[model samples]
Target: MEPTNEDYTYRAGDIVYVFYRNPHTQDVANIQEAAVVNNPENPNELAVFLYETYYPLTNEMAVYSTEEEAEQAYHHYFGGI
Candidate 1:
C-alpha cells in the first residue's frame, strides 16, 4: 500500500504525481507527472496516464496533487531527494 491524499477528490484533466519505477532498471525510481482521466474501459472509474500506460486510480496508489508534496513523500519513504 502507498500513501494517498484522503481529502483529495480525483477528477479528469487533473495533474497528479506518483512514484514510478523503471521497468528495465528495477532499482531506480522517480516522481512522475501524470494526468487523471476517466477510464477508457470503464467510464465510472478513474485512471492515470503515465509512461504511455493507463493505471487505475485507487487508494492503494501514492498519489500527490503537487510536486512539492510528492517530493516530500519520496524523501520520507525512499530517504532521498
Candidate 2:
C-alpha cells in the first residue's frame, strides 16, 4: 500500500516531506524538479532530486501509503483548514 516513486509528480513550489529509511527520520523540503538533471549519466529519481528546506540534511523522500496520511502530515507541518 506504499506509494511508489512513479505515483508522485515533482512540481515547482510543492511542499514535500522526505523520510530516510536508514535512520528513520522525516524532513520537510521543497520540490525543485525543474532544476533536476535527467540524463543517462545522472539518472533522475524523484526521491533523490529534491531541495531540502533545512541545509546539511540527508533524508530520502517519505512515501505515504495513502493520500490521507500525506495530507495529515502536510497539515500538521504546514497548517491547513
Clashes of each: 0, 1
Residue 9 displacement (Å), model 2? 19
lDDT of 2 at 34: 21
Q: How far is candidate 2 from the true structure (C-alpha RMSD, Å)?
A: 9.0
Worst 10 residues of 2 by lDDT: 30-39
Per-residue lDDT of candidate 2, residues 25-65 (tens digit): 44443212222223323233322333332222112445443
> What tens-digit string does per-residue lDDT give for candidate 1 at 8-65?
9878899999999999999888999999988898887889999888899988888999
Worst 10 residues of 1 by lDDT: 1-10
The alpha-carbon RMSD values of the candidates against the true structure, listed in the order shown, are: 3.6, 9.0
Model 2 steric clash pairs: 19-62
TM-score to true structure, per model: 0.91, 0.28
Candidate 2 Cα errors over 4 Å, as ranges: 1-59
